[model samples]
Target: MLAVELNGDAVRAKNGSMVAYDGRMGFKRLTGGGEGLRGMVTRRVTGEHMTVMEVKGQGTCYFADRASNINLVRLGGEKLYVEASNLLCTEEGLRTGTTFTGLRGAAEGNGLFTTTVHGTGWAALMSDGPAVILRVAPGLPLTVDPGAYVAHTGELKQQFVSGVTWRTAIGEGSGEGVQLRFEGSGTVYVQPSERTTLGGQL
Candidate 1:
């Protein structure tokens, strides 16, 4: 569970993610991520839809999604890339949008567009289990399974890699075959458990 202390402030959270709240709080559903018509149209066209609600009060508000482990990310003018299903909440001041993700999205079976959060605020991410934070520096690249990738901060490049071989075609492929390679400087959050991806079974 994630708790947000609000002193008459507001927060944007996933719709129906509120578990409990104290003080006088109000919940309102925002259309198009609070961007109004433009956002609604974009989401409708891209197939990357998000249902968000705004919570405002003077006490504390609780949020949870599927009781999954939550990870907090603090962004300072940097973009955070995360899957739409993994995002739980964001500070009201933060901005959310969708971007083209190429083959990585197809490999995950999560569509070709992923969600991005920017600005300085708190963003909550969810995973099947506790997430591991890995630091990638110059020359120290990181490779992650598509199903295991949660979210990442800072500057990074992602590439799709495959381990398909004759054996793989004959049902003897390595268990850890396809992976998402990340290079550059940043922090990556990976969950211990991996969701079943289309390529993961191969």
Candidate 2:
């Protein structure tokens, strides 16, 4: 569970993720994650959906989702690519959008579009287990299992790398088969426990 204190400020959270609250707090279910009509249309067209609620007023609010471990990311004018289901909460100033992730998103069965949170604020991400933060630089790139990816921030170029071979047809393939390679400068959050993905079985 994550607890955030606000003094006349607001936070956008995953709808129905609030566990508790104290003092004067107002909860409003946001249409299209508070992006209004255009965002609603975009989300409907892209099939990347998020139900968000805005919590405001002076008090402390607690948030949780499926008892997953929560990781807090602080952004300073950088873009964060995350799955809609893994996103927990964000400060009101941050803007949320969607972008195509190509094969990487398909590997996880999460469609081709992924949620993007950009601007300067704090956002909370949830994972099945404790998430490891990996750094990627110009010389050093990070390749991640699609099932383990939770979120990432900074300027990163993602490439789909497959380890499938003739052996894969005979059920003798590496469990870590397909991966998403992240190059450039950024930080990636990966969970210790992998989610069940189509790539994991392939």
Find the candidate with the highest TM-score and give its number: 2
- Residue 102 CA displacement from its true place in model 2, Å: 0.6
Candidate 2 lDDT, 1-202, residue by residue in tens:
9999999999999999999999899999999978889989989998999999999999899999999999999999889999999999999999999899998999998999999999999999999988999999998999999999999998999999999999899999988789899999999999998889999986
TM-score of 2: 0.98
Runs with alpha carbons beyond 4 Å of true place in candidate 2: none
Evaluate candidate 2 by giving its C-alpha RMSD to the native, one decimal: 0.8
Tell me which residue pairs clash in candidate 2.
Answer: none
Please, what are the lDDT tens digits per residue for candidate 1 over residues 1-202?
A: 9999999889999999999988889999999877678878888887888998999989999999888999999988899999988999999879998889998888888888888999999999999999999999989999999899998888899987898778888999997778999999999999999899987987
What are the C-alpha RMSDs, in order, of all predicted structures? 1.0, 0.8
Deviation (Å) of 128 in candidate 1: 1.0
The worst-scoring run of ten residues by lDDT in candidate 2 lies at 33-42
**For model 2, how many clashes?**
0
Clashing pairs in 1: none
TM-score per candidate: 0.97, 0.98
